[model samples]
Target: MEANLTPQQLWDCALRLLSRRDHSRRELAQKLRQRQFDPEWIEQALDRLEQQHWLADSRFAAVQVRQHVLKRHGPLRIRAELQRKGVGPAEIAQALAAEDPDWFELARLCYRARFGPDERLDMKERARRMRYLQARGFAPDHIRYALESADE
Candidate 1:
């Protein structure tokens, strides 16, 4: 089933995928391979896309970061997700640093939204809230401030 696609067909499929959303080079390659495209032809298609400036890891990472931030996800989760999508470490660092989101504020907002305004929580309740924020990928310090402070 995979071997029937000509190079043009494979290239067209790649473009269709990119048309829907940005994809890192590795991600695009993986998608093509999954569709049963020939490995050699997939590489050629990727190289062509790269040369034409249609496929870029940096652009993909930037878009992913923006979307994740809008969804209220933390830096740790965004970084891990980008890495999972096969973005390189340097690009990941650059993409994360380029954005200037208030991580502490984000944590607070997420906590409040999830558990509501800070009532006088018992130790177990406080710990539970802390765990929730932590699972959302906030750092410990940010979680502490979110759980302990009354700053809205």
Candidate 2:
């Protein structure tokens, strides 16, 4: 891959990436780095983007949370994914609060979507459903709420 692009070219590359999707500043830096861009140039380019509000961690976090919620993922998984993308804790928390997803309701929806609504289950099936919700990143309490509410 050609990695000898000028600073102008590097800026353009960043723009092209942002045009496709919102990217956290760190994520954009990593992407540019993967293409073998100089670390210093990448940082400077990122700074320019951030100064201009073209790249924002908060915006990226918000977008990520919304997208994952639409995909029926739980908060724990969402938090981990955002951290991996280099979002700060404060931004992640603020984004989550801004979205304000009802965890229990979301858990129930995911549970129902996966296992169907309120079918009687043996111990084995019950354990399987719990595991499924757990894997989807719901808190233990949220999973319990989702499952228990089905009984009422």
Query: Which candidate comes out best when scored by TM-score?
Result: 2
Q: What TM-scores do the predictions have?
A: 0.93, 0.95
Measured with C-alpha atoms, the lDDT of residue 65 in candidate 2 is 98
The model with the greatest lDDT is: 2
- For model 2, residues 117-148, the per-residue Cα lDDT tens digits are 68677999899899999888899999999999
Per-residue lDDT, model 2, residue 86, is 95
TM-score (C-alpha) between model 2 and the true structure: 0.95
- Model 2 clash pairs are none
Badly placed stretches (over 4 Å) of model 2 are: 1-3
After TM-score superposition, what is the CA distance of residue 32 in candidate 1 from its true location, in Å?
Answer: 0.5
